[model samples]
Target: MYDHASRPGKPSSKEEDAPSPDKPPEPPITRIPSVLPDAETSPAATSANNTTPASGYAVGGGEDGGDNGGANLRRASTVPSPHFALPLWRKSVIIMITSFTALSVAFASTSLFPLTSEIAGDLGTTPVVVQVTNALVLFTMGCSGFVWAPVGRLAGRKQAWIGASVVFLLCTAGTALAPRAAEEKTRLKIFVAMRILSGFEGTFFHVTGQTWLADIFEPTQRGTATGFFLLGTVFGPAFGPCISGIMVTYAAWTSILWLQCAMIGVGLVSSIFFLPEIRRPGDTERRKAATSSVLGILKEFNPSPVFKVMLLPNVILTDLTCGLLSWSQYTLLAAPRHLLNPRFHLTTPLVSGLFYIAPGIGFLLGTVVGGKFSDMTVIKWIRIRGFRLPQDRLNSGMVSFFFVIPASCLIYGWGLQYEVGGLALPIVTAFFYAGGLLMAFASVNTYCAEVLPKSRTEVIASKYFWQYTFSTAGSGTIVPMIDAIGIGPASTIGVAFVLLGGVLTFITAKFGLQMQHWAQRKGVGSP
Candidate 1:
């Protein structure tokens, strides 16, 4: 019999193997007790009272020991909770407006594809030059978030969002006028410059919107809020081409940019008044202190939550899986024209652009369903285990990873490749594929947000920054990959990635608690 090395006292019973108390608890939401019971302050709260100066928090006058006063402190720590309920009618109106703004910018980002040929012809440039502008814009958008995330951390969310919209509006107007402003050589330069500027400005809708929702909503309500946010993101890309296709057919290429510019103006005005500033008093102080060189200050601010997450092998592996899944998403968006035009022989922009609806519909439904089911499942899991863990949400992605991604890629790829089915078949497959993508995204993104509730804005922003960077790479390489490998092989590779993502997600679900313990043992962030 083989013997293994062990400590003098027969290795402790496996039953005693629970994570140490010093490690931060799993499911960051549950870890933070409901601001502690008002009347009976815990030791943690008492310690905080001694350590935090009077200036550190906003105070409302109350009976010295009143429980209600504690609630006020909690409120001041984040967005000051609205004392009077917002009228449902007004709330709905703002949500719609914000959603439309996000969709319009998103659509502009991708829709210009269908008009590339028409735009190039009018501007007297090769189509390649016209399309290069798209790539440059997207690449710029990916990096812009890194710069904006820190700024949003410093300035309030509403102000940051408005600033981004202002930039976008100016860039859009510039692009609309660029064709007539210069010679063909200079035309490309102007176009590229405008697109890059627009891309940079586009970062606001993603980072600001996400952080804002975190500020306003409680943990339980977050899934629904995230679902709505996903709708804006999903619909923007899905409908961008469809709208652009119609505009280019009926009007000039300049109309697309002009329309976007006008919409930005409207959104900017509405957001300024409607989107409340959600900066906490504590965050305000931190931002002021951080004014001494942004880079140095951001470095000083702890990234322990993010770094500790990486220390868990499963999280790293799972992030890669998410990256690979995103590769197919950007590739599909980038190369659709190639497949639609040649195989279906769809010549008109309207016919080619209509193809987007199949997937867009799927994405919308997936987000709603995924968000609800993930929340329900998380609640059920907590009951059964008699304990809650943040990794529970990671399990929600398993269904999407194992079934939706691979099946959708294979069917969508093969359907277009052989032209073996009716238009409806491809459309249905596209919808399912999109649904899976959004469902997976809902889980993956929420996991990031929930795992670091205290540093919610930076954590959420960091995730998007990295995710969009993957999107940039996928968008850039899609044409080449499709050209070299052809659709069938390219999709097969995507399917393999989906499988890998599933395996890693399972690891996160099962061993995440243990990993949290290991991080603490290795001296990670405070509990």
Candidate 2:
């Protein structure tokens, strides 16, 4: 009774004969459906592609375009689907390995702090010169993101991770074997150069590692994943000084660098075998094109995008907030050695270094708890509003900003100022302070990764650009500021900046969507 091919949309015999021979045939209609059908057609998907799934989520570009605007719009469509879906256990393993890799890099960066005097004496230099090496490493670490972000873009994240680890391992060995020169200046120069090379390895772990995690996890699960990843980052600085204090107490200062070399070697080998290439489907072609020639590679190295991300109001606010937090973070790392050594009249590096454990534990707990809490907050807000926005996660940071950080910083500072509770008070306060910092950090870090998914690596690089610029300033000047104004006032300055950052964060959370629309309209971060 019915013909199979004669559907309502198709023309029957009479209609089919109406067209002239010169008329061109219409192209076949193609529907490239999403993995999750509901996601592709949902109301929220039509707006901005922000939605949570019941079990797993779908991946696709925003309706308007990829976050990099028109220039990357075509690339967004070409982005390959993930090669394979990894099991949860396998995904966890990858995250853990990358986190440890990050930890090793961070540990090497700050290990010299507790051993500054020992390193200076051995090389016939002053503590000032040794301290300059610390600032140089931090500065280099921040700037290295520019170079490595492009490498990740063109060469593949897997290669970037392995390459950085190998280079770090070699550089750590070089630092350990640095020859002592007759002149202090010459020896210092060698150490500075080696430290810079080592610092270059850090950006891969921080930037590319985060980028990799974002690639694997869904929005619902990303907060938890990012939190765990940050544990390695936050704990490394605290643990670095703790370990270095013990090492310098018994072993030669060079032994610390040797230990870093060994640890990094393990990470390099593990990453080579375990880390999979999670490139998009068409990314292989993109990678080949990007690497076709010297000019292609250089074209991929454009740092303009990193600066352009800063043009967005939300991004600049987040960057400034992170910069403010770095002031306190570095102050915490640098001050302990200076203040504890003198205040307690301690002789051994081990005793002074033991003090770092309190904050280290705090940093560990905060990242884990804060990360889980952020996810919960997102879920709760989704139920209330029936949709999710990236800024919703920022509400979790408010507690850390208003209460935990300010109170603990005051107790740590003024407690030392008036000598109220001795070393115990400041140590306990340091624990809470570090905890608060990480809690706030977890929300912001996750937000950055989600803000511009199309150009996530570049956006993240921009974050670190401002974040570490302030960190370099803090690391270089915190001790001097303590000397000039007393610990209480210096710490109060950090608290003021924290409050300002908190206010900005609140404003961004409330108006972030509007700001994003403005950014999109103005083409602020267009490639």
Candidate 3:
């Protein structure tokens, strides 16, 4: 097994990962797996002579939790080789398919809403018992983030996707078909297990899809690509409940899961035929050096890498910021159904469902525009500095984080308290707040890949790790919190979270590179 054996002592400044401004920025994404004596002198080392090191060669980190200097082994486990140089049209297609898959998974996450009672009746249990399953599914999705990368590294990226899809399909089927002929206890247990298992596939799609898009696009254009890719994620949750609400009115509650199954089928079929392999590097020695056995990979598989990644100042701080943002994001999303129906004497599920559309539109506009602006910022920064750093793009999303989200959060929360603008004003605030949320999400999502490109999978996965954790907390507590303190106080709490997150991101944008450089010296990340 490859090990990130740390160098014995603090190294000189020259040993730091920071590159000279005059020289072209070394691709920081991937590396050669084993630090072998004869490896660099071998034929493979000679080949990388012509291309970019980090991006061009397409290496990945090992299961042991650090960069292994390995260029992709066969597109070794998902690192897209720049040598392949896919066409723009082909890359767009890849992004589209992955985005659709992400959307489908996002849909699955929430489509069961308002059906808890119906499902519980079938299982001879209370709606409350069935509803807890939703939270568990969400929790499971977050937990699964840690698994996707290691399994991808061990099996191959394509295989990992296919395997997760297959498992998800089977689990969905099980959840949907909980054996009505069986006893209630038995049926409920089967349904619960299957639903939880299906959760495993959700974050894998969301986080890994981001990394996959990163695999194909360069840093200069990744924000735009990521923004487009986020369409599925941003819209899925918004539409899922609406569609499910309408569907349950007309069809079986299980029909929602069945519909989700059909969507997953479409995505799976598209991927099976069209999703390109991350192609391996050209040299024979490089392939040999990058290769590893599945058993060996699993033996060394330590899930701690996800946690260890948090130790980095940039990662943890940005993640902390993301955590706070998520607290507000979920709060906004969860608030509407609770706020809208009672406030205006709106009784129908459909009417409450309509409220989600406001944020959905905001999410759409925010992602598309935010993505473009982030890329624009990257190009502007590169032109000014003569090179790009991962943190350069963070400045683009600051408007959303600092001004847009905070302001919108306060307005949305307080408007309901004082009955300020009726429903119209609150809907508008929801739209902007949701927009601000995705805008920040787009920036941070792309940054995860660049921050530790070699360990791109882990970095991205771990971000979701913290993101889901905060989101779950917000969803679980916000309604009760509001009931106790009123919407005004609840929103004030959310705004506080937004401001703190904003300050943290500002710190990162300004000093993240220095923090990352210091972490490299301390072996904090794979830098």
Candidate 4:
């Protein structure tokens, strides 16, 4: 489980290949055929640059020191390369800033939940009407990836990110200043429109962030980086209601939107200053080859594989597992206030929001820990088998699929039904539920990205496209389903989904390699 390498537990080489101390390395070859040359290359030669051999993969370069030679030798021996040198702290900061921005948008998207009652009252509408806004936002955010991904590919990561942030900021500000429903007769419409617009902007951040992280982090350290990113996304929805709950009570519901607007502002500023470009080595050549018209960039970025993956039996089945498992996930956040607020007579938004902490903590810890464990276990599996496959991560997720989601759903639902709605019941159940989700998600996500490394922009765009689409549908339908069926039956339904999801996950883990073969056979992600 451990190694003495400079990076971390993972070894730099599969086998020990020590460099000879006496060798003076060949002069660094700028013309080597690898990915693209560094940006420092003059623009005059940019057009003539051909596809180079893979050179960017080196984790670090050796150092050169004067005089003593031993210190330089040691530094050169230990340090991989300095060509792409970035301190871990800098990488982590970028991850935090980008991830937090993405997550804060996610929170703002759902932050209206704690204020649903107040919003409905002020707007002269029922809770159902307010709830519909939440549903549409999820749907829009999911589908919006198609639009954003192509733009990111064309304009570059930084430009596209700032573009999305600008839209998010504008829409959020509008939502805050929207007129009352009675006075404007169009206030609800305006609010809903703004939320949907924000959702579209929000999806860009997730897609961009996913690809950007993949570009920056090496395979071994990806888990911790991804874990931090997941923390932002997973914790946001859970944390949204709690913070907004306080804001709604102390200030107007508008204050939550205003706060969101400010957050978007921060994200926009960070993106302009800190976000770096992450095009592939030969991406410029590929893009130029693909199209000459500026508008053609959008046209060339097709969604066929994305749709094909969606239609795959295993992929579709995996999505079902994700969707069903998420039933409890979304429902817990959406409908809990109705139960607690009425039964316990807890009317204050802040008090109602306090209920989210149980699931929120569960989600954060589950994702962070699960991601770390996945990284660790994959190494173990590689050691045992004497080879490593990308799908190995999928195998690790099978353990969580069997134990976590179903158990948590049962405990949560039955605990509520038996009139055991104490704090401990939901808290314990939530930990398991959240754990299962992260475990499953980490695997599927890593597998898809790895399998389609060349087509990552499109692949990830497709992944989020479906994931959030399912989330939208779940958020839209969960409350109504709960209303129709009692908590006992509602949870039973969730358990049934979890069971199916578990079975599908098991099948994918077992057959994921074959699926990859199939994808390759079909030329799904060929470079």
Candidate 5:
């Protein structure tokens, strides 16, 4: 619920937002609350709320510290201070632990990729059957966030994580211990069901973790903090198959599940003992007071709100940006084995595992460097304009979107197509392509949270929804497409999508304010 000239996060009186020669102008980044309001904020009512402060404090927080605006961000929270009070160290620890959940879930999703033969043999099925189940796990992991993120939004974030953890642990064990003696059909059904359910439990880590982290972090801190948070998601894919290969060599295929279970066990223990509730104090009592029946509580899980968020012009456009980027992302992740194996005659598991190091290192470098750059970009814009729009962060990713990815992907594709530079060329391109992919992804992920400050949960859910949809499509089709068309041509098609994503980012960055105005006038964002 941002006023056109107002700072982001907290809404305020129009008088406060207006610039004067006497007072300091609005800072580019406004402070967000230490705890987000658990319910949706009515942005359409911004007109009247403009006459009043959002809470007791001035909505414009002190840009330098607790000095300039005389506003404390925590004053925006409705709950008593103690419940939402998290020390700095606690916040870091929580984020660090939450990173592992994303890593572990992503780890479990692909750990079976290298052990398809072992899994199929145990179930008395073909490797193809095992592969299909794994693909579904990845797909379900993305789709499930639409369901679980809303639950975290309406219930407590801590509660949702705890429930998911326990369920995920149980489901992983079910997959691990699926009896070999059973009929193949029964065993496969159990295997698929448990794996899919575990995936469902896993996807919420991104949505819920980001939301909780957002609640505590200020606007300026979000980009770098998010980089840390997303570290797991970007690296997990490359690392998973590497570890999976190692596990199946020395231990049974079930060792992957056991490892996943161990990670879940740590997460469960940490959630109970270490993770503090991010909800407002007495939030439970308030929910009870507000809702009369079990049906009322269950209604929050309905996904229409998520789709409604999808209707916002800027939001939908941003989601499309992510969806298109995913085509390139999964293409990069999926293409190496198919493109490199025959081209370079590299077939060893170690060779395959080692190849990931290039992209993994690139992803690692991008997240940290790109995240810091995003924040710097936002500040640069704010200093120039005397204010910041959420979309200002998009400028930082332009390098990757326009130049790094398209250029690198094309070279990688055609280099393979012509066998021009030998194996080294493809590996080099993978690093740059992967680096560019995550560089573009980092700012976009944070923008999803920023674009709808009040509806961060739904907006982010929408992000993962579209991200995974395209990811699943690309993963399923890339190898076949490469076989049909040369890698260069297929990659060109992917680059076309990446170029479209850049155009979308350009539009959002340029016209985001107007688009938000249009969404409000059309009442698309209204409850």
Candidate 6:
């Protein structure tokens, strides 16, 4: 039987492991615990009771307390207890709003792709220049997590969401209005600047919004909630082109920006009224101690801590695995346009764009099903081990890693290389390839959020930092690799990387608990 009362940092002994005969055995855990009756009060809460003034904040206890000393402190000081439940309908609304917010940001990032010609023609610039603006938006969005994560840590996540949304809205409006400039160079400069500004919005949706979901949902339900949240992200790129293609056909290019602004405005308003604050005043006070001054907050901005998290074996393995997955992901996204257009002898953009819908559907199914599967896997492991470890969730994605992805990539690549079954085979393979990517992604992504629950925001930021860097590299290099080597060989390389990632994930799952214990013992990555 598992001992629920054991606290982290307490020395292990036979007594600690043995269940008491005097008390009856507790029932198996099927639902989240509603109270932390056996847990200690948070350090901040204890301090507040003594000399420090009460900040009127309630803190929640950790789910499992072993070897999570700093995590316990952070969670106990910041997050509310699961007992403070939101109504089911309210939770549903929050999920919908968050998904929509993610969709709006993601839509803007790629919506410009289908409008490149129209935007170029309107601004008196070349199509390549307009494309560069889109690239800049992506690059800026990837790096902005470093800035937003810390701000969310220090001030509050709720404020960060609203502020980023508002800025995104204003930037969309500015981009829409940029065409009115008299000089072509001025118009181009204004448009690019506004796009760069808008890029800051992406991390809020991807990083902070996911963090918010983690805050509200218990471990049992997180997989499904995360899957739902990922829908916005998975479909955005595919839907962006599809929606923009239609909008540009019927309306002006500027109309796309206007629509983005309206969507963002709705998100901003919804967040302000509906989003709950996970970090209360006492939590902010505790955070302030970590960043006591303006200089202290500036010091917190350094990326060293985020990089230091990579020193942990589990975190590095997770990061590298995510990077490899990203390479495969971008490969699929980049291939259709380049390979399909020439092979099919296609001229229309709409027809080529239609190919995206297949992968989009695949990603959606993968995340939703994958997430629920992950939770089930965790429960199964918990029953077998008689206790839970965060890494138990990783096993759920192994099939995707080992078989589903490799087979799909080979089928997609080799099929296209040989033109074996025309468009149907590759298109079908692409769907499974995308499905496998996201199935693996949902597990790894949720694991990242839970791995260091205390420093989740920063940990997630680091994951994105490495993941996007690889994605940028993949996006830039895949076309060249395909040009130099045959599509089959280029994709074979991606499959090999995915295999390596699967091996790493396996190592992490089998030995992660040991590694985490060692790190805690050595005072490395305590949080």
The RMSD of every model to the true structure, in order and in angstroms, is 11.1, 10.6, 10.2, 10.7, 6.7, 7.3
Point to the candidate with the largest lDDT. 2
What would the per-residue lDDT of candidate 5 be over residues 225-306, giving only the tens digit for each residue? 8888888877787677767766676778788889889987987888788877765556677667436677776776678888
- Per-residue alpha-carbon lDDT of model 3 for 1-527, expressed as tens digits? 32121123544233566687898766433222321111211112112123344322222233432222222211112433472278999888888899898898888877776456678888888866765787678778887876666567656678788888888888998889995646878999999999989988888988778877776776667889999999998788777777777777778888888888888888899999989767344433433434555455555367777778788888988888777887887777665767777889976666777777788799888888888888899778655533355777788888887789889888888889999998899989989988898888778777776777656677777888788788778877777789899999999988888888878888888867557546755766652
TM-score of 3: 0.81
**TM-scores, all models, native as reference:** 0.78, 0.85, 0.81, 0.81, 0.83, 0.82
Question: What ranges in model 2 sit over 4 Å off?
Answer: 1-84, 180-185
Ranking by TM-score: 2, 5, 6, 3, 4, 1
C-alpha positional error of residue 496 in candidate 2 after TM-score superposition, expressed in Å = 0.8
Report the C-alpha lDDT of model 2 over 290-340, residue by residue, as the tens digit.
898999999888888888888989988998998898878988898787887
- Per-model lDDT: 0.65, 0.77, 0.73, 0.66, 0.74, 0.75
Model 3 root mean square deviation, Cα atoms = 10.2
Candidate 4, 94: how far from true, in Å?
Answer: 2.1
> Could you give candidate 4's per-residue lDDT for residues 1-527 as a string of tens digits?
21112233444332344446797544221111111212110011111123232222211111221111111101111222232357788788789888888887788767887677788777667888888888888878877777776666677678878888888889888877665545755887788788788888766787678777766765555666777787888878888988888878788888888788787788788878887776666678866755678567657566565676565445565556656655556777777776667656786888888878877887788777767776776666545533234555666677677777767878887777676867677767866776777776776665555444555555566666666766777777776776787777887877776667778877776655455545544655332
- The TM-score between candidate 2 and the true structure equals 0.85
User: Which candidate, 2 or 4, would have the higher TM-score against the true structure?
Assistant: 2
- Between prediction 3 and prediction 5, the one with superior TM-score is 5
Cα lDDT tens digits for candidate 1, 1-527: 10111123454223234457897544311112222111111111222144243322322213432222221222123333451145655545555666667776777778787777888887778777767778667667655655665556667667677778888888888888888865887776787788888887664576566655655554555566677776877788887887777877788878878888877788888888777776554777777777768575675444454444444444555556556666667777777777778777789788888888888788788887887777766666545432234667677888898998789889988876676786776788888888898788777766655554555455454455455667777776666787897887777877886787778777777765445444545655331
Write model 6 residue lDDT over 45-154, tens digit each, in one string.
22112323223212222334333222322123234556238777777787888998988998887777656777999888997677667766776777878777667777
Which 10 consecutive positions of candidate 2 have the poorest summed lDDT? 68-77
lDDT of 1: 0.65
Worst 10 residues of 4 by lDDT: 39-48
Better of 2 and 4 by lDDT: 2
Error of 2 at 158 (Å): 0.7
Clashes of each: 1, 2, 16, 10, 0, 0
